[model samples]
Target: MGKQMFSKPPIQKSHELLLPTTKESCWILVFLLAFGVSSIHGDDGKIDFRYHHYLDLSRVLNDTAASCHEISRVYSVGKSVEGRDLWVIEFSDNPGVHEPGEPEFRYVGNMHGNEAVGREILVYLVQYLCSGYQAGDARIRRLIDQTRIHIMPSMNPDGFERAATLGPDSPRTSTSWGSYGRLNSERIDLNRNFPDMLPVWLLQEESQRRNHHVEIPEWYWDTLVAPETLSVILWSLSQPFVLAGSLHGGSVVVSYPFDSCGLRKVMRSYSEAPDDALFRKLAKVYVDGHRKMGKCGQVEPCNARNFTCKGGMTNGAEWYCVPGGMQDFSYLVTNCLEMTFELSCDKYPGEDELQTYWEDNKEALLSYMEAVHTGIKGFVRDGSGKGVANATISVEGVDHDVTTGELNIFDIKTYFLIPQRLTETTGDCSFRGLTG
Candidate 1:
């Protein structure tokens, strides 16, 4: 006999307590139950899960790691102001500490509290890669062997918890600092708090009353001097790995280079310094990938004519003219290639679409990752076989990776452009480029 499909509910009407079973009926019930539970868990009228529910995610990651010991490990990068551990899960096939010379990659999610899906995507990717790789999945194994993936699931744990605990339908008008969800308890926009690349002076009585000692908001002052941003800066500066992508949401877009205003000025001139072609190439890859995913948005250059620069605050690294943005900073300061990937649409899509987004982005992300592993090395040469001077080269694409162990921010490589000057000659000038 085939398996029975329907079991009577505990409470039934007197008229009909018994019913015939059917396989289709059983399948329907199972589907409904699964869908209902997922919807409930992903409730609050948004596809994103509540931030405090990260504990459940942690458990899921732990279970997957235990089952597939070689491909994944859960670790902490730091602690939030609220003292919650900033969890980072490393996914790679290489089971030991990466040798000094090995390539690495970093993928960070949830830098902002409201953009929570990245954490889910990171977790899902880890599980998928581990399971897929163990099954002799060619693509998975290749990615694992070639690159190391360092994923920070939640950069702003405090903000995430606050947003989630507040519920999705909560009033947008809430005035609490946490309700705004951009800053910590101290109300500093981490993105804006970086050292200002171009500082504007505000002349006030305090400005005229300079003193050796002054009382100020300690948290504000301390954050202005915080070592956290500096630590990430130092870490990325010390590595030679390929690409890094800082993931965000609210719009499906991939942004590249010179996020701060001064850098834009430097890049505007044809002779002084031009835009990097490598960045353009990567942007193309991202745009193509998104288009393939049915998301038809162009990859916008960071320094486009219409790009916004005014009112932009620089981080510490940016202020010292350090190009200290996570992506631009990695590229300009360290010469490591990086891009800011804004994942998903402006209004949050439903949870049902999450898997689809991942699938669509897989190839583009993988291609970019591969580009980083094999450094995109090239030389611009003139017609006379001599190197071209002041010629800019940019390469852009989806960035992905696998890591050996403890994927440190410092370990990821930056995309670099080595400009060499060619002596002036009489022959008609032409240029050439190459990548490994």
Candidate 2:
């Protein structure tokens, strides 16, 4: 029993203190307490925490699948200028929705890079749905069961990386105009660069003519090719029964069709026909959702019953005639119902206030989701059989509305469509829905 090293504490010290007299003695007490707690608590594991960021988000998505074994897939639509993969994570009980002929509900975020909360919200939404489903939450389960959600967390990864690396304090007035951190190398506003080019240009030119000045940035004319912008347009065009929205930041608002020149006459001039009932319904959905968010001040009445038209830049199917853009292209080529959602107030709200924004907008966001679930859409055509230009279209059930532009149509329901213009090339058009 050589030295019986460390076999016991000093007898004299133990007697003096009436307690553990050595470091080894203290270890035993700590271990015992830990074991006792474990025994009592049965070792509940750590709670998973989620945050915004592509890699971290992907890991969370992977962890979620491993933990719950739910149905989900991370698919790439195209490559960014930096060669980063632009991903769309699909979540649904039925992954089969990706199969040919199935409908899709698209929710995209971070198109401008500076507005990153949508990425987090989208990721959180997935986690919420999956966790809720596992926990037997009926509403969550039903939504997943009925709808296929396609979430593109960061549409402009190149720009997003630039923004993240430069930090938040970087001046917005920096001379570097075409960096991936701000806009594409071409410097075109991705939000304004959809395929509906003609209507957009017309509106832009009209605005300049009215003001008797040219304020359009030089960069707008410099970059003609937008890969990131093109990919989203192409992806939307490929989908069926698609009700899609592009999420942006700055003034909190929900804007629908006729984004191009925002005049009633401009809209009417472009749309071969008019569809008042449909326009009113779609506007109502947006109006109702905005009211719930405490954003009553920003919700403007659209060009429908008791609604008034407010002029703004034309984008989407209602304003432009183009070959690209998520909404315009989707409406022109795929016949999907699409809209753009501006989330959060200007200057990007602080992280602490993000929850409030979410709470206010969640119902409105879900209304869009609900619209997709119900498969509600409408179409407008001109007299010439070519899809009409600047026509107002709406969905009766959800109160969603959009104006259609040259060679484009509007989808009220899932935002999917067949290519057909109004029979009249230059005059008013007619539209009908399930109601009215």
Candidate 3:
């Protein structure tokens, strides 16, 4: 089949609020998007949902980018330990361009290379988004028109190759005790290699402890960091990502932030964040949309690993203390509300089951993408109507605040757009001095 041109979809009606501004200070005009979640259909049996090698995945992304040039494009964030590109395929009305007021969302899969289910599902999701938009699927059209969706199908290509070499049915790789090919080429657990805030928080006085938008610690450089971890960290800090999902396997549940706990070495402790309620809501969106995962806040059978989660959602720390996890890094170090989705109990499921897994997760994936637009998003501009740089925006009651400014980490400079006032739907917001 040849490429098809997709006509632009009409913009949906957005509720715009224009607050008065002064010449000396910048004002923020916040608007809310009409929240609508719907199932996406249009499985044309064209794009195959199979386990892809790094080269094959690259080609798939490239081909999709060419076919869906109007709404999708491919780019690489960085390389893995073994020099594999950490490619990201983005879908939007205007591909590769950042549109003001549009929230950016991302899904990162195969962080643990052995957990191949998410990587394959994400690849399927890429094809679905592109095909759905081209096929005039209304829900998908809305998603592409309103939000920038970035999907990195594989974050640990080196480990993935290792796992694929062992084959899915290999007893050594399939065993619960053995975590073959789970680490990157450097043999470091990427999830646990990020700068841990638990250590920093414990050392700080209660009054001095910073929870939200936490900075990377200086001593973190003294330790060995995985290339994949650094790449993701730098990539995240460089953007104004509003929402994200880290896909994993070996469990079937949705878990939200504070993956690490203040209580040292605690196996089961609830380390809740200030935006705990909002995080729970975000996590529940996926769970409720999932076909098997029952409604959030209610006990449901997962049917895998004999696991049952109340509402198929859990607080990350309560599930298990994972120090330096990506979920926590996203919430604390960047303007991204991240959740970890344990998509399947089988980490390296057979490729033949990819389509079934995709069918089970398609709605949940799309619904979560739609949820990004459910929050307040707008622009911080000066009296001249130009975006004000280095503006710190905060809600009256929310403990966390987002900044619009330049951040220099590991000597790499990152400039971020003004993030959404991620707080209550109805609340007063305050902005700090314009440093632009």
Highest TM-score, which number? 3
Model 2 error, position 431 (Å): 20
The better-scoring model by lDDT among 2 and 3 is 3
Q: After superposition, how far is residue 83 of candidate 1 from its true place, in Å?
A: 1.4
Angstrom error at residue 1, model 2: 74
Steric overlap count per candidate: 34, 55, 1
Name the weakest run of 10 consecutive residues (lDDT summed) in model 2. Answer: 25-34
lDDT by residue (132-167, candidate 3, tens digit) is 888888888988998889999999888888888777
Off by over 4 Å in 1: 1-52, 169-178, 196-231, 234-239, 263-275, 291-324, 347-350, 374-435
Please provide, for model 1 over 17-88, each residue's C-alpha lDDT reduced to its tens digit, 9 standing for 90 to 100: 111111110000000000000000111121233323567767766776787787778776556666666666
Cα TM-score of candidate 1 = 0.59
Across 155-202, the per-residue lDDT of candidate 2 in tens digits comes to: 877676666664443224353234535564445557756544334434
Candidate 2: regions farther than 4 A off:
1-51, 65-69, 96-102, 170-180, 185-188, 197-223, 262-280, 290-294, 297-325, 375-436
Error of 3 at 373 (Å): 0.4
TM-scores, all models, native as reference: 0.59, 0.59, 0.82
Better of 1 and 2 by lDDT: 2
Best of the two (2, 3) by TM-score? 3
